[model samples]
Target: MKVNFKLACPLLLAATSAFAGGNNEPTAHRYISERIAQYGEAVERCEKIAASRPLPDESVIEQLRDYSIDDVRIFLITRSSLVSEICEKPELTELAYAIGVLEGADISGTPKEIVQNIKQLVFGEATWGLKKKYLELPVSVQNILKKTDYFDKPFDDIAILNAIENAKKP
Candidate 1:
């Protein structure tokens, strides 16, 4: 039987809430959380600056292009509802969704299929780590790897919003 790997939107929001607002998970289990908190701030700052500025000229765009993987990581972290009630940025939300897919697939497949599975799960997973591993894949498998994760339930945008809203409640 086929299994659906896609997480419900509410579920993803719940998980992000648990990770960010729950009791501190043991440090061994906290790499993603700590990383999220660190990067979330950076993403917020960048968003503020980018929003206030006029369309960046090519030179500024080039400078933004120099943003590192760490920057991407931070964007995903902050976008996950750790810092706000709603993740309004499509780019940030997409990044979080992709990372969640990769983390899920790594738990259930061969390293190669694991790589492909995640690439398929996230819209742009190939442009990152998968480029180096592309040659080892079969043509048929590559086709399978291009599909999106099937969602049995629609994502709950409000669950994340709720989590953010509840963060400071007594």
Candidate 2:
């Protein structure tokens, strides 16, 4: 059977969530919750900034987290929701999406695909300006970018944005 990887990814994530305790773990989401708590201030700060300053590329910054693959998935899910209820804009959420994409590509994808993905992300993921805004990204998103290595090179939002806007993708 030919499985659709895109559709299967969410199903796989659901299965992973369901079996979160299959390994005799004490808590499936305790770490996640604690991380949110740990970075609570930073996250709120970022959200506040995003709300007060909706532009993505402005010279500013807030929000936070230390995480794993599963954590990124959770962040993607939850942060997406947060844009509607907690924040006025989706810059932080979009950053989460970018991190998720880059992380997934890092795990399994080609350079060409990642190039295209990065290009796409820069387009709608935020306001067009990348200089000041990229510098002001939330602590959590920055950490993820640093962690998600592309071709063994760390993912830099400014560099990727510049590549997409000025130079050839990748």
Local lDDT at 133 for model 2: 48
Candidate 2 per-residue lDDT, tens place, 51-128, comes to 343222221111112333334333333333333223323443443454454445423223223324433433344423
TM-score of each: 0.26, 0.20
Q: What is the C-alpha RMSD of each candidate to the true structure, in Å?
A: 18.4, 18.0
Model 1, C-alpha of 35: deviation from truth (Å): 0.5
Per residue, candidate 1 scores C-alpha lDDT tens digits across 20-102 of: 32232233124433333333444455445433433323442333234443342233233222222233345445546545654
How does candidate 1 fare on TM-score? 0.26
Model 2: residue 127 alpha-carbon error in angstroms: 19
What TM-score should be assigned to candidate 2? Answer: 0.20
